[model samples]
Every structure is written in C-alpha cells, then in structure tokens.
Target: MNIEFKKNKLSIALSIALLTNLSLMAEEKSPKELDSVTVIGNENSDYKSKEKVKLNRTKMDIEDTAKSIQSFNENFIEDSQLQNIENIITMSSNTVYNGDNHGRTNDISMRGFSGVPILIDGLKVTNKMAHPEVYNFESIEIQKGPDSLQYGESSPGGIVNLVKKKPTKETLGKIELEVSDNSSYTPKLDVAGSLNKEESLYFRLVSVLKYDEGWTNSNTETNKVFIAPSLSYDVNDNHTLTFMAEYTDETTPSSFGTYVNSKGNLVAPIKNTISNPDEEFEKTQKIIGFDLDSTFDTWNSNFRYRYIDYEGDNGNVHMPQSYNEATNIVSRAFASQKQEFEEHALQYTLNKEIDILEFKNKISLGADYNKAYSKLDMFYDPSTPYLINLSHPSYEHLTSASEHSGVMDMSSDKTYVESWGTFLQDSIYLTNNLIFNAGVRYSESKPKNGQRSDALTPSFGLVYHFSDQTSIYTNYSESFTPNSQEDTSGNILDPEEGKGYEIGIKQKLFDDNLNLTAAIFKIEKENIAELDPDDPTLSKYKASGKQESRGFELDINGNITPNWSIVASYGYTDTKNKDNNNLDLKNIPEHTANIFTSYYLTSFGLPNTYIGGGAKYLGSRYADENNKIKFDSEIIYNATVGYKKGRWRANLSVQNLTDEEYVDGALSSNARGTRVYVGTPRTLLATISYSF
Candidate 1:
C-alpha cells in the first residue's frame, strides 16, 4: 500500500539535508570539501573520502553496492533540468522508458526485464537489437540484480552504466538554450581544460544540436548531432594516461507505420500535423573509443577499445489507413525493413594495491576480446497492394518488392560473432571494521551458426563498519549471455545464464552531507531469448531455458540541507515465468516508485526562485504471454521552476503533471501489427544557461 511512501519521502527530505550537511561539513574543515577532493581525482580518487562506492572498482559506484543501485550526482543533474539521457533515465527507482518505433531507439526495462544491458566507458554498447544513449554522460549507474557480474553475456535484470566525461582541472563548463511546444530547437556546448604545467594535462569537450517538429501527422521529424572529446595525462608521480573520443549522428522521420489499428495494436491515429509514415526510417551509428591507463607503486594498468556501426531502413505501409489496408490484397503499396550492427572490442586490466602478509590487499585481473556482426532485410509486394484477406482484420505491411512493384525479390543476410574473456577480483581488509569482496569470470563464445559457449562466473562480498556513520553489505554473483544472430534458418540460440543475490545498507547521517542506500535482490535465468516451438512465425528465435527475478531498492542522495537537495528512488519487482508458474512476463512491473525533491530558497528568502517536485509510480502490467491483455496502473507528476544568477540560468518545466496518458512502452500481444508509443502528454519546457 503506497509502498511506504517511498520511505517517508526520502527519510524526511534526508533528515533535513542530513542535518544541514552535517552542520556544514563539521564547520572549520572546508577547503571546498578538501578542494573538491584534493583539487583533482584519479585511482578512482581513493573513492573520494568514500561513503559507499566500490562496486568492484569502477564497475560503477555512487552509493552502497551489490544489486539494487542508483545515482545521479552533479547535484541531481543541475537541480533536475536533467538535460536528457531520456530525462535522467526515468529518474531511476526501477527504470522504464517505453516509446520506441526504433528511431534513435529507446526501449528499456529493469525490474521486469527486457534484454536490459548497456554500458559506455565500461564498454559493451548493448545490442541484440540495439538502442543506446545517455548523450556523453559523466555519471549514471543503475543496477538491480546479477548485474551480469557487470556484463558478461549480460542482462540479468539490470545494468546501465554511462560514465564518460573525463578531463577536468575544473574550468567547469556549461552553455545552453532550448524551446519546445513540439517545435523543438536546442543548442548546447561544454568545454574544459587544464594542460601540462603540473595541471597534468587535461581536456574535455561536449556538444549537441537538435531540430524537431515531432508530435506527428505525416512528415514527422527529429534530427540530432553530437560530438565529444576527452583526454588526461599525468605521466609521473606514478604514471598515468587516458584518451577518449565520441561522435553521434541521428535522423528521425519514421516512427513505425501501419498507422492506427484499433483492436490489433498500433495507435496514434493523427492528432497533430506531421508524417503519417509515408516511409522513412533512418539510423546512423559511428563510435570510436579508447582508454589506456598506467600507474605504478602497487600496480594498475588498463586498456579498452571500441568501434561500432549501425544501420537502418523502412517504408512499410506508411499509413494512409495503412495504405488502404495493404492495398486491398493484390497490388502492394509499400514495405521494407532493415537492421544491421557491427562491433569490435578489446580489453586488458591489471590492478594491485597490497599490504600483503599484514593482511590488506586489493587485486584485480582481466582479459577480453570480441568481434560481432549482424544483419537483416526483408521486402514484399505481391502485385502492388499485397494479398490481404488472411482473416482480414485490416492487414497492412507488404512491399519492398525489390523496391516495390515486384512481389518477393530482396532478403539480405549476415551474422558473425566471437568472444573471449577472463577475470579475477579481490579486496580484503578484515580489520578497521571489516571489508571483503571476491570475484571470478571466464567466458568464451563463438557463433557462426552456434554451439561453443563457456562460462565461469562467481562472486562474494561483505562490508561491516557499523559506526563511522553506518554500513552493511553482501553480494553473490554469476552471469552469462551470448547468442543472437542466427535464427531464420541458421539456428544458434542458447547462452543466457544467471545467479545473483545481494543485501545492502549504507548511511552517513549528518556528516558527509547525507547519503543512504537499501537493497535486496535475487536473479535466476537460463537460456533466455524466447519463442520457437519450431516455427514461431519464421524470423526464428530460441533460447528459453527459463527466467526469474526479485527485487527491492531505495536510495537517497547527498547534501540534504546545505541548500536543500534530494534524489530519490524505490523499486519492488517479482518477475516470473520460470516454466509457466502462470505465464506473464511480457512488459513487467510489480511496483515502482520515484521521487525527487529540491530546496534552496537562496537562504530561504527566494532570490532567483527555486522550487521542485517529482512523483512516479507504475504498477499492474501484463500485455501478452497468455496473461491475455492488460496495462492499467499509473501515477505521474512533476514540476519545476528555477532561476540562478552569477553565471546565468533560467528554467520552467512541467511534464505529465497528472495529465498522464500512460504506456511508458508497449508492444507484444503476440506481435504483428498494432504498434504503440505514448508517454509525454503534458509537456512544456523552456531553458537558458551560461557559464564562462
């Protein structure tokens, strides 16, 4: 019931900003918080005076570890203006982001599971059917279970890491302007630098551009471009080096077609002016990544590389009553679909920080290699309008007859996959309050057509420290996932294994400006990737060994009162379908929660106005998999208004403030027609910013 009001609205607004930043960092000891952690950071910056973080050193951290996790930082994305990453990734609390006609692609799920796996900076830019974004992030980690030991045949109910954004000597940067009413326009730029002369060389660059006219009718729109650059070097005093690069290209116009279909699926029957699908689905992907690091004293070394290519296409039915219901059965009007992906990977790691015999050690070792390729293309047009009447409930899609007007000529193909890996981890302290962690990973996969998947995953953990504020931890892990790129006659689909358990607790009451964490998790999966009793319609897919999930999480972040702050979260899920306990695992959701608070009246007198609000709850869902059909549960609210001075800032935003229409993502009533994508009905955004 009301999920315990997400823990009394984040423990009473973080017990009043954690007793006012613990009485101002315990007064008289602030050199800007030790000069923002000693003017610079690295070696994960000794975890910056740590409070909770060390999910296997950079697997990711911000709060307590082992399952159920979340973080936003950067003062909750500049006090919630949340510059996209799909709006702070649904503000965690059991993530979900429904809409996807597959343009720039967006479709995710975490507690209820849906191939959830994404990483950047930690690599593995997801894809069994791609969709990635977080537009050059600098922090954003959210996990829940079996974090696939952090991606190894991944996705066991959670994982989303998008770190990027390195290179800092603090020349802090920001610049922006935006407008929306469905006639979008945006421009943003960021810069940072501090080179040589002991600044140890550093650099940062971020850029973005957008154009829109979306909210459709028949010539839809959404265009984008992005660029990023990063570099850091410290060559001596222990040796160090790093370099990174990014590029993005996006084009949108095809928001999936076959227009409106009342009872079979597909909605958005025109209510705005734009493209009605007349055919146009475009996608372009290019990414080059690298990072090399070295340090000596106790040992640490690194290497990572990435390359990706994405492709796209479409013209299918394009609306017009789905081209008059597939051209009345014989003269096909249009149809074509395409998909492609390519990737190359490399990884190397080594770490050691020992105190040996005295009993204090930290060690990690790694190895990796990967090569992948995928492809698909289909077309139709049996006479021009295609042969409809197959129990005609208004059929649609049918074209690509080699380019239209031919009947069944083109159908491309391609698939290749390979992989290798090794890993080991350790972190034991035993005294000073107890600390322990363990790990193991081994993977080997091959796929030309199938067979040859090996795995060895293991993990353990513990962290006590009851007093210096608080602490408690536990972890158990195992993971695997590999298999995709065969189906449609080539076979191959079996490699989805998982096992995980976690318990957590962390607190810093008062001092350290507030931070709390609570977690519970469980995961079980096998084979995964479903549908194939022999011919589940032909595009062929299989791998269902079973599946399972369980969860609980709550997190509240920093600076409760130094000026009022809050970053909330909540999640409770119990996914199923492990050999039909009553089948229903299509869209997932048991209960989800989210809340974000803001306070800072400029010392209360309200100078340059600032106010905040947030609420989100989603439950009751099941729209396929023998559950029949359903999707009735919703709660949403958000509000914000702000003003800042000195470097200039302004804002106004209101989203789904109870004007909710719902359907954060939908599709799967046995598939084939009746597409849907909705969520974002009451929107009004405006922005301005500057910093030099």
Candidate 2:
C-alpha cells in the first residue's frame, strides 16, 4: 500500500509541477509567440536542442518520436564530469551498470535484459563487447525497447549510440587537467578548426592521457592513452565526405575484488590483499571509418564504411570456490587469457520525401553488413593451487605456473560471426498533427560453430500532436537474439524472439525551456537458450525458456527558472521467468530514482558561479536465480561547484559524498564463485579548462 501511495504521489507531484509551469508560460506569451519557442537552449541553459535520428531514418524533433529516447548533450556531460561511459550509464534512467572487476569494461542492462548494442555514429564498431573512450564523443543517445527493425538482432534492453565531434569552420579548442583524490591524474586536449581557405576542409583532434596509483592499499597501478583525429571535406554544395580514426591503450597490473566465502557470504579480505602480484590487464583498440553524405532535390543518401581491431590480454588472480570454514583457509588460482578481434562493416541508407494522394510521405531504405572474427586463448593454473589464510593472508607464495612451463593452452577455440540485414520504413502524415510509422526488417546471422539463423521483424507506431507544446505517442516493436550455442546435431537453436509495446507523452513548457516525459512499456520473450537438461555440456544447448517484463519511467530535464536547472528520473520494473516458476531475474532492481538540480548565483553578486547536487537511489535486488540471496538497497549523493569567467572554466566535483559502500556490479550466482565489484568511495576531482 505504501508503494502504491508513493507512486501515485510522485506522478501527481510531477503532473502538478508541469501544469503550473505551462499555465505560467501561457500567461506570459501569446499563442502565436509560443510557436517560435525552441526546446534547445545555449550552453548556459540546461536543455539541449534535439538532433537525434528518428526510427524512420529522418531527422525530427525528439518530442515527435513514437518511442522513448534520451540524449546526454555535451553541456551536461561536462557539467556532470562524466569521464567514462560507465559514468554516463549510471546517470541514465532505468539502467544498471554491470561493472567488471577491472572497471575498464562496461556492461549495461535495461528492462530486465542485457547485451545492449553499442554504436558509434550509427555504425557498429564491435559486436564482441567493448567500450570506447567517452571523451571522443560529443553526444550519447539512449534508445529504449526493441529496435531490431533498424539495427539487427539485439536483446530487449535497447541500444546506445555515441556521436563523435566533427570539425567546425570556426576555431575552437580546450585544454584541461584534473586531479582526483584517488591518486589519479589526467590531461586532455580538444582542438577543431578549418584547414583551407575555402572553409570546406576541416579537422578535429582529441587526446587524453591518464595515470592512477592504486586506489586500494595494494601495489596496483593503471595507465591509459587515447587519441582521435577526424577530417571533413566538401566536394560540392550537395556532397560531403568525412573520415575518422581513433586509438586507445590501457593497462592495469593489479587485480583486486571481493569474493564469496564458504558460508555463501561476500567478504572483502583486506584493502591490501593482492592475490597475485604479477596480475595484469592490457587492452588496445583501433578504428578507422569514413562517411559519404549526399543530398538531391528529392532524396538523401548516406554511405559509410569502417574497420575495427581490438586485442586484450589478462593474466589475473582468481578466487576458487573451495573454502575451509574451520581453518579459514581459501583456495586461489591463476589464469591468463588473450583475445583478438577484427571487424569490417558497411552501411548505406536512402531516403525520399514526396506527396502521396494529398498526404505527405517519407520513405527510407537501408542495408548493413558486418563480418567479425575473434580468437581466444586461455590457460588456467588450478592444479597446483595456492592456499590463503583468510584471517591473515600472504601472497608471497602465489605465482603463475605457466611462467616456468611456457605453454599456454587454448579454450573456446576461435569464433567467427557475421550478419547482414535490410530494412524499410515509412512515415505517413494523415494531417499536420498526426503521423503514422511502420517498418520491417529481415536479418540473417551465421556463426562458425553453429547453423545460420534468420529473422523477420516488424514495427508500428503513432504520434499525435495535441498542441505545439504537447504530444502523445505509442509503438509496437519486435526483436530477435541469435544464440551462439550449438545443439547436439551441431545446429544452432532458433533465435529468441521478443515483442514490445510502449506508450508515452512528451511536453514542453516555459517557452520550451523545460521538457517532461512519461512512458509505460511491456515486453515478452520466448525461445530463450538454456542448458540441455539431459546432456548439460558447454557445447550443447536448447531453446525452451520464456521471460516477461513490465515497466514505467518518468523523466524531466531543463530550466525551471532562468537561474535554476534540473534533471530528474524515476523507473519501476517487474520481471519474471515463466519457465522457472516465475522466479525474479537476478541483478535487476525494482525501483530506482535520480534527481539533480543546479542554481546560478548571478543574482547574488557572483556573476559566473554555480552550485549543484544530486541523489541516486537503487531499490533492493535479488542476487540469485532462486531469489535466495539478496542485496540491500543504497542511496548515493554527489555535489558540484564551478565558475566560468572569460574563456576559462574551473570545477570541483565529489562523488559518493556520504562514503557509502555498495556493489556496483556482480557475476551470476550460479557460477562457481560470485565475484563482486565494490563501488568507489567518496572521491573528489578538480579540473580547469581554457577555450580559444
């Protein structure tokens, strides 16, 4: 009963606030004048103008789209000091970060599912799961629900796209240095300008270098280097070309985390605990891409090609499941795994605008092809394991046996996966205020170890504009996920199929300075891949499971007043596995909320100063499939202060202000041993930037 009351109260409070703001705007501006209002504001304003692509392959206002989409603009990214992709995911609505032990790789979950695809500038960089440097992108787009019609196969969670910063005609540059309480130091530079007198040749360059001493008491350290360069050339008024390249290298020589003890309890042995002194993680990534954009009198076209390479080596310490409760002695192991990946992809789209039988119409056709190859070599030293006294531990005896043997075995062999897809979408306008959307796609995927899988998915949506400031939208979409596991006959199982439905409302108030969104959605998935009951082996699988999820979300962003800005969101999700006796899914919270607000002190004689704070809450969650183990809820706080004068800006930000200890990510409970990643404690960062 209390939960219901709180939900109602939140909905009522937000509704009242939005209505009050709308009424006040109505009194200040005439209807004709309101028509000229824009939802996007300047850098100083909290709101950003909409520049996201719609499902129909058309550039339209986000408020007019039929599905839920969110944008984190450059201004907000800087204000929040979002230095990494994981930081951005933490701030997104209805999202959860599945942190890896190393804190370098990111896996995000939404709507009770995982494997959310990540794209760069509408192109797939890596399907093998990788994270790009956050500093290379200008904006990040979050699309919710089943998007298989546009992309290919995907989980029900949704997708994230990063848009890179392009070259500009005017000279713009910024250099910044940051110092963090966690013994971390970073230096970054961004410069973009034209290269020729014609103003048609432009270039942009971005670089970052970071080094951090051990955050824990262990003898661990981390270092990273990143560089990106891009160029743009205009052949004519209707034709343009762009080229982009990026490289990243990161290394961490220490492995530190908590482990599950014999009593099935998570234990942080010690701050100075180092299972293996020689443990290290190293990664390198490179990407090169080009874009060809053309515009004709009645049609528009875009063609893109990209090649990406990624390699990683991890020689890390491990905690074994064997623990002696009486003597407090736990077993430890070691592993060395190396992974290599290469991908080549091409994507093209053609769109035409026309008038059909007095109704305006926009039609688009697109095709994408991707080929990926990956190899994995893993060696584990579990035979001669090391024993550790949990009460008083010493790692002097722990060493890799392979260092002396010089033989590295291989596991999982080599994997090669490829996919191709074609799609068609159309948007028909019944009237200037009402729009209908429909799309269909056919995709095929083949893995080296499994048979081919094909899927045909379709989507439909509608958007109705009640007024210039308000709109209501609804969509029905389908999705499919290909299984990499092979059956006893060496044939892949049928792809898991999912269907989703969503309805939402978007509104603009206070002369388009504020934006509000509310949405409700549900998804059902079938034919989920599961272990073969009779012959449960790593090489065999079956598809006979089902799951369902229902959720609702509310979000608000923009300026409440000329001096005050706010961003807030609330999400509620309910999920169950039907075949598993309706057991709750693991690692998904039931309720989550985040609120951030900032105010300028210009009126108080501090012309260029600002202060802001935020709060994040995650509800209790189940840790295992049977729901036997659970993790308690937690609330975190953050604060920021900044000043901008002339071309100089400086900011100080603190995270986890209350020093809360929480688990940011974890592995499945069904595993041999559950690995838990502890969240960062209270930390401070100070940065200063100068722009020209």
Candidate 3:
C-alpha cells in the first residue's frame, strides 16, 4: 500500500471517532461542581515545577504522582543560559552527557542505558542525531524508569519531553543578543499576543541565529538558524485548537578529539583536533503539528498530530581506528554518509473524574499510532588509510573527494517501522491521604522486511500522604524495544525486554517553598544483542545478553527564602553485565552530582541584581566493556551575574571557571580505545535584553 494513502485513512478514521466522542459528551447532564485544583509554584522562584505534562499525559501534581519525575521551568533555562538538550539533562539525577557523536548526535545516558528517545510536546521525532534547541521551549521534563505504558518502544532508562511555548492572550515580547569569548554570537527574538479584537485568537513567534568559530585548534566553525511559529484559536468556551510549526538549519564541524595510546594515556592536547578542519556536517529539519482540546460537563479530551522531516549530509568523515605510539601516528578511515528520516504520530486521550462507590477516582485512557521511515547511504575507502601525526597535524587533505586512488565501498539501507498502542490508567482515592495507581498497555510493532513483535505491559503504584507536606510511593513498570537485527540464519531476534522497581519519598521544607525527593531503583534488561562468541569475523550476533542497573538518587529544588533559589541533585549507579562475569558497563559514571544556587541582592540595596554559581562532577568510568582502560573524573564550575531593571536586563556568565582540562566523555572504544571527547575550556559570555 502507498504510505500516504495509509496515513490518510488512519487520520480520517481517528477524526471521525473524535467527533463522535465530542458529540456524545455534549449531551451528558452536568454534575456537581468540584473543588478547584490550583497549580503550585510561582514565576519569581521556579527552578522546580510542581506539575508535569508527559508523566501521565496529563497535568498532574508531582506530589500526587507515584513516579520519579524532574522538571526544569523557563526561569531556570533563562537564568542558566542553557542552549542545548545536553546542558539541560545533565542537571537531573542519574543522567550523564555521553559524547556528542562528533557534532552529529546529542548522545546521553540515564541509569547505564543509552539511546533514550526524545519527544516534543509528548510526541516522538525520529531524528535522534539532531540536537534540540532550547530557545523555544517552556519546560523540560524527565520521567525516570520504563514508561512503555505511555510511550511505545522506548529505552528502559527514561524519556525526555520538551513542552513548547504556546500563544497567549496577553501581549509579550523579548529580544536578546549575546557574545562569547570563543568568537560566538547569538541573537534571539520572541513575541506572543492575541491576533484579534476579541482576544480569542493568539499567535507566537520565536527565532534564533547563532554563529561560533571553532574552539579547538582545527578552527571548526558552526552556524545555526531556528524558527518556530504557533497559533491558538478559541473556537468556543468548551473547545480550543492550536497549530504549530518549526524549521531548523545547521552546519557544524566534526571533531572526534584524541584517543588513548598504548600506555593508556591521552594522546594529544585538549585543544588539538585529529580530524580534517575542512570537513563539515549539514542538517535540515522541519516539523508541523496541531492539537485540539475539548472540555465537557463530565470529561475532557485532547487529540494531537505531528509530522517531522529531517535530512543530513556528513562530508569527508574521519574516524580514528588505531594509534601507534612509537611513531606518534593515528590511522583513520575516510568516509561519507547521508541520512533522511520522517515520522508521523497521532495521539488521543480522555480523562474523567468520577465518584465510584463513594470514593473519588481519576480515570485516563489513550491510544497512539506512530510510523517512521529512515534511509542511510554510506561510502568508505578504508584501503587508503588517512594517517595523522599527533606531533605535527595537517589539514591538506582533499577538499572534496568522490574518487580516491583505492577502491571505494558503498552501501545503503532503508527501514520502515509502525507501532500502535492503547493504554488505560486510574488513580483511586482509597482515602483522603492514600491513593492507588494502576495502568496497562497493549502494544504492537511491525517493521518492513522484519518480524512482528507485541507485548502487554502493566504498571502498579501506591502513594501514601503522611500529611500535606510529606509523601511516600513505590511503583513497578516494564518496557520493550523491537529489534531489527537478524542472526546468522537470517532469523529476526526477539525484542529486548526490561523491568523496573522503585521506591521514593518526598518532603516539603521551608514553609513549603522547597521540594525534596529521594529514591532507590533497580532495572534489568534481557535479550540485548551482542557478538556471537563463535563468530570469529564478528559479523553475526545473538540476543542473549542481560544487564542490570541499581542506583539511588537525591534531588532538591525551589526557594530557601523569597530571594534565594536553588537546584541540587546527587546520584550513584552500579551497572554490571550478567553475561560477562559481571563486568562494568562502559562510559557510565558511578557517581554524579550537580548544584546551582542564585540569590537576589535586595537585602544589599541592589534590588534588581543577582549572582549565581554552580559545579558539576562526573566520577571515573571505563573506556571499554572489558574495563581495561579507565578515565579519571573531573569537576567543572560556572558562575553568572545579572541585573534586571525596567525594560532592560544584562547578564554575564563564565563557564569552566578554572579552565579545567579533562575528558568529558567517549563515543566508542575498542581494544585500542579511540573516539574520546574533550570538555570545553574556560569561556565568558555577556548578554543584553529588552522586554515589553
């Protein structure tokens, strides 16, 4: 069947069902008025948000939900000046910034698991290599542990969801410019307001332009452009419609940094680059989506649809394969690739609050469908090795090479994946201070030219509120990810399965201004694909590997006083491969911690001035699965000062304050241990903004 035709058919069916539900809801009689529910937290001190949107596909209070969820609001994003997803996620407990795939992907890991999926407004986008820009987001939410009941075929670790800024009825505008010591400049604009006299139609526009000269010796430059526009229309008192679109174009240099030598030491200086300076990676992405929300006398419903298109071309790629310390030469491969990805997703959810057997119950049910297509074409000339002398690097390689002296190998792959799932959950209020949460999902996945996989996942939780300021909870959940890889016999492997268990406690402190949470969790995954021991060439694989991760985390956020704001977290993780004599997982730190605090100077007579500072620490980790090579730990510090008065605001930030030289993370490591990444050097940035 034609892809477009199939999509249209599904869309039409979903639309008709939505209309029918709306019609039925309209005829229901009104019920007794319920007490109003108020959202907590204020704009003045909002490092921590009290509510989350994607945890359960509804705006639920964090204290009432029996899950470990962390949220960073707009105030924190602006105060810290975080630009990318990597910077934002590292602040959360048990999360690490894995090496960026040489400017290709925003690689990250949580609880010893990598490749965690990212979502925009509770919808998945298939382009994992494109890093999400944070300029247009209102908040970032991270749900820890398996969440297959809400999102299908996701990593067992967790999921990151970005809530976009929407159009508002009141006029608001802001323009800002920033310059950094590393020869980087950025300009941004945001405007939102009502578009009609009745104040029922609203529009919002957000845009950013960024340019940066290379920070390393290779002088690899970067340029990026991002724009987002959205509209909201109040069709009636009971219904609203919102439409949004986004476009992004970017070009960045690929720097793989240096590798570990035979002596198990870093081969090059922190500022040096091993890749050719002329090579570049280009990417373009576009998204279009719409959402409809309806409220009736007894129930509420939301329908959302999104489509994403992404393309990329990596030119003249260089990958380090091995290093000879005796000659100070690194043997690398010359390669190139192109990739295209597209995704279409639809979701509908309904929620109702009712009295069952004289007890209040909140019921939620939803269904979702997603389809994605991806294609990759690669070219390599490994016979003609590119040798780089670490002592004296050279950038005189071919500017554009389609023909080499050696034989060139080319390959291509195309894949199509479609998945659908339905889930139902309920929160039963057994008593005024106790609650029980249970949910289940039926999920199925079908891949072109691959086997079909299905699973039934269930979750159970209980929350007990000791008082208005204290609570304790425990939960269990399961997740599954379909596998496309085949064995030596051409038989598809079974999907990977995971199960998680967690228990946590929450407490409100300092007049209910600060929220504190501590939790312990254990997760196990089975059927992980690994190389077959009997396959000498290592070209074939089996799906019999098993791994486990156990960890404890502590987090605190919010205000200590009216003028003092803080965010802090610490996590310890232990991961082992059950199939390999309990070896440690590669690139996963055992300990991680972050803390940031800011205070207004009102008491010191500078009412509009503030100062903030923080430090991030990553413990030592192994470079390879065998744990033969270990990388040392490091701490990076940052500080900021800002002044806001009238319509003008100014700020200055210093990153890597002590000019720390350290290995940030690694992408991959073989017996030779290559593809390591270096942390950023000391840099200063200043910004000026005007608001109306």
Q: Candidate 1's residue-wise lDDT over 131-239, tens digit each? A: 3334356566666666544347776666766666678876655666666788776666666767665788889888766666666544535555667777777776666
Most accurate candidate by lDDT: 3
For each candidate, the alpha-carbon lDDT, in order, equals: 0.62, 0.75, 0.80
Q: What pairs collide in candidate 3?
A: none
lDDT by residue for model 2 (1-692), tens: 66434533443454345345534644676777545433212325464535565233555568657888777767677777755676676566777776654533467778877767777787765543345667777777778888798788887878877788877766666667777997777767787777888889988999877666655655546667788998999999999999998888877654445554433455653353536554667788888989999999989999999888888877555535455555666677666677888999999999898999999888889999998988887777666567777556677544554453643465776678889999998889989999998999999998776678999999999999999899999999999988777677777788999899999999887788888888999989988888877775665788888999899998777788887887778889899999889987877888888887778798898868988888888877776778776777889898999987765788999988998877655565553555556666788989887654
List clashing residue pairs in candidate 2. none
Which candidate has the top score in TM-score? Answer: 3
lDDT at residue 431 of model 1 (Cα atoms): 85
- Mark the regions of model 3 whose C-alpha exceeds 4 Å error after superposition: 1-45, 262-265, 405-409, 534-538
After superposition, candidate 2 runs with Cα above 4 Å error: 1-45, 53-56, 101-104, 127-131, 254-256, 260-266, 269-274, 316-330, 389-392, 401-408, 411-415, 536-539
- What TM-score does prediction 3 earn? 0.91
Task: RMSD for all candidates, in order, please.
Answer: 22.9, 11.3, 9.9
lDDT of 3: 0.80
Q: By the lDDT metric, which is better: model 2 or model 3?
A: 3
Task: Please give the lDDT score for candidate 2.
Answer: 0.75
